[model samples]
Target: MLDTEAFRDRMATLPHDLSEYARVQTGPASWSAHPHAEELSAWALEDHVDPALVRTTALLVDISPTDVPHVAVPHADVAQLVSHREAFVVASINGEATLETMLDIVGLPSGELLAIICSLCARGIVALDRSHRLVTR
Candidate 1:
């Protein structure tokens, strides 16, 4: 398993508000930027997945069987279907959104919504909130 506590400690030091799409941490050694870094961070935190694991998983998404364990989000299909904007929007209101609100905002059929959310849940991108509402991580 990933060192979640250590990852959380590292994440706490980052700027809460970032202007870029991606930021990479090289374990106190170096940092790089990605086009989807911030979005990834938001998704990971909300879902309770370690942010470092998210980054590592994203990097290995295209490669089969690398040293690191695989993560389910950032998959090719999921990436094609969702954008950073969608992820950000989902993560922001996941705590408060009702099914009706989500239907209105996403403008998708009920079946589609269920399928998309199910896929997200499988990938650890979305989860149930304390109130049992669907929330994105």
Candidate 2:
């Protein structure tokens, strides 16, 4: 008894790139994606992501509803995110806030939060306004 149109309408309310979030239930490993290695290495460890940059950075939606790159075959991390709704919410908030604000609002561990953002960017659902640093989800 799912209402697909209502769901699409809700998605439309978000600032995302007109893409639909896939409904899935599984561990992140099950999603089958390889969030870019370069991105992970660049931002994951020992990197406080420069307070100035984090303060100024914002995430943007890139993929369209019909073009959510991994909807048909999700990336491994997407499964992990299935339960981490806060990360998705934080991503949406990124439209106006900086990463520091995202961290303050979401309260996820920085590494985990950065990973989630990076994974989403890798997937194509989100992007840093400054660079293609993260991809999608």
* Candidates' C-alpha lDDT: 0.49, 0.49
With candidate 2 superimposed using the best TM-score fit, by how many Å does residue 64's alpha carbon deviate from the native? 25
Candidate 2 C-alpha lDDT tens digits along 1-137: 99999888777354565323343333344322556766656655456765434432432243221222112223455456444553465334425555666666676786666655655555444545544235558
Decoy 2 TM-score against native: 0.33
CA deviation > 4 Å runs, candidate 2: 1-87, 90-94, 131-137
Give the per-residue lDDT of model 1 (tens digit) for 65-93.
11112124444554465666545335434
Backbone clash pairs for candidate 1 read 21-37, 22-37, 43-137, 46-137, 47-137
As a whole number from 0 to 100, the lDDT of residue 124 in candidate 2 is 48
Lowest summed lDDT over 10 consecutive residues: which window, candidate 2?
A: 63-72
